[model samples]
Target: MRVLMRVAAGVLILLLIAAVGFFALAWKGEIEPVAAVDRAQFDQELIEQGARLAAVGNCIACHTVPGQPAFAGGLALPTPFGTIYSTNITPDPETGIGKWSEEAFQRAMREGVDREGNHLYPAFPYDHYTRVTDEDNRALYAFLMTRQPVNSTAPENELPFPYNMRMILAGWKLLFFEEGAYHPDTAQSEEWNRGAYLAEGLGHCGACHSPRNRFGAIDPERHFGGGEAEGWQAYAINTESPAPIPWDQESLAFYLRQGWHEHHGVSRGPMAEVTGNLGLLPDSDIAAIATYVASVMGEPDAERQARAEALLAEVSQSQSPALVDAAPAAAAQPGSAQGDGAAIYAGACAGCHDGSRPQPFGGLPFSLSTAVNAPNPQNIVNVVLYGLPPADGEATSVMPAFGGVLNDEQVADLLAYMRERFSDAPAWENLVELVARTRSGEHKVAIRPSDGIERGPENVGASGGAED
Candidate 1:
């Protein structure tokens, strides 16, 4: 009995010691004071600078709910666990960042901690924000501060049990978050460095472009080779991508500035929103991003290269004979002979889709275009239905929504015309089916190709039609 009593006593002492040690560590981890800033000294130039940074970061895209004031957050971002609503960052005393000091803002941006010292979820992208330069951070703060404050409170995040507990985020941060500003590469040019900083840091491109590990944290080693977000497969941005079209700096800039590029392709899915927002940024910044992305094109591994090459080869070899036969049938139709497609194309699409015309406004020629020529018809269908805006930085182009103007048949006709005139690819009867499936609520704004049934090589020419 005495020995048992001594064992219990030892266990109690150990527990007490552990409890004390944990408390001590928690106390030491308490957040420190924020650095001071003189808001009174802030000027118009700084405010404009802030606005530019905000554009680069695409802050409004995630923060502003439809019908809500800009930056007055209420956007629900769906994650693997549940939906997390964005917080209002406007300077409203009751509901926004009005109470936050510069230091608190910096802490949240750099360390993934909130003003209350609670660890912020990685959904906020603080892991990438940690790389933003202090100067840019200050500018962004200034811009956000000057915005009109709306007194709307965002809804609480509906995360799973232990994840719901904000304190547990501290452990998540310990595992994933890194502290500090961007370290400029001395060997790289200033433009490249600037682009790198923006893409990896404030822009948080990695949040969407980089692959994630099992824990839902980004796989840093993979960088921006591509990944999935909110069920949408954000296509690989790397140079070795299996995409039918390869991206170059000029094409990248055109895509960034205008949303669509000749031979490369148009931005669709979640990227359309990104391009719409990026359309507001300056041209130089867009060019810088393009330059940086172009520089990093050779990073894909051997397996990826082999797979991409095989897919390309298969696509090339499998050009449909039936599609080639159907071209004459389309051209022989009396209405088509009278240029029915031409009138519709000219009237509805001419403003933005003139192919290879050397004009900034119209789309480059669909004839022989890689996007048009690709075996998969999803890209063309998506562009026509949703339309695309130019990139935010220099050379902005806006793609008007044709959802109202064109019917499913008209869209099909246009696609058929483009395919017939440009490439030997087959006509897509599945396009109407694809459109209906995409229009269904199953997909969010972005069309997830994987969400739908995939047609196999045999089905490609067989009776397997697209699902409506």
Candidate 2:
């Protein structure tokens, strides 16, 4: 018994010593932060480039809270540990990074430390940001410093116990963080390489799109397979899409550029914000990102894709043909009474989404829609429950939310009906529960598409129209 106790004590002491050493080395990183007085001067060009880089980083998305000054940073990000509010990143000296030196800012990005030499939470995504070039970091600093300074102070993080200990993040970083700049693939083209850099580095698409392990590290093998963010599904840009149509370069570029592609469907939830930021990027940059992602995602089975597309086309033509007026055609298989799936679609959804209206107002042929054909019908449910809002603050045509009007079973029936008619994919299970969960705000957009072919027309992009 004494020996066992002695051995346990020794192990505890060893762990204590190791923890102390880890903290010392993590904080004593090679970076020598520059003095505040030695910060770089902000050039106009640098500011503009910084703005572009910021867009690439999607800085404003997480930093700015709704109805708040941009970059004043009060958005609360929910993690498994607890909620962490985004810090003020505007040029305010007290609450923001206004007083930070270039090296301090660089250290924060590269080493995950703050101006005060404290470990920053990985929620800031310094893990991926570490790969950003020094030049780009400087530009980001310039852009940030030039922004309108706000004095808003974010609420403190609400983490529990040891997880709340900022010191623990050092170990997390040690375990997972790999600091460096992106190295382009020599075998790939310049465009492809640039896209790779953007996707892997500044864009940090995988951070949100890739599923995380229990340690809160992204599962590398499932990169771009789709993940959750801010209560929305970051759809897979990989081959694992539930999208009926395979995404190619042209389709992706169109979706990213317009936020609404005819066949792919409109961006909503978090993706709308992403597409909005992508709009600020150069066309070539957009094209490059599309090129790389499409290549990596590769194509789905060609034969499966063809059959689904054909099925979708036939369904659309037969069930919801172009209307002579604003009226929908008779239902193929009417339900005996109210709440029948086809009847519900015709009465509630078909007028706007039957592909019977003019450009920008009509819906995609159900066969070509990414939403209906998605592996999970949550996107369809999202549209049905919350309705599609004006994207990017632009008052494009809008769809009314059905949360107040439709019951859970009704929504489920409508969705199942859509899958049955528009897609040859297997009908989703637990739809009633899915709708209820979505209504209660417990559901997220699907990251992984269920096994099936996502068939659709090529280049069928973010088309102008309201689709359910």
Residue-by-residue lDDT tens digits, candidate 2, 395-422:
4435777888989988888888778767
State the lDDT of candidate 1 residue by residue for 355-421, as single tens digits. 3222223344454245576555665666667655433232322355576787776777777766666
Q: What is the lDDT of residue 254 in candidate 2?
A: 82
Q: Each candidate's TM vs. the true structure?
A: 0.67, 0.84
Worst 10 residues of 1 by lDDT: 448-457
State how far residue 73 of model 1 sits from its true place (Å). 0.2
- lDDT (CA) per prediction: 0.64, 0.72
Best by TM-score: 2
| TM-score of candidate 1 versus the correct structure, residues matched by position | 0.67
Candidate topping lDDT? 2
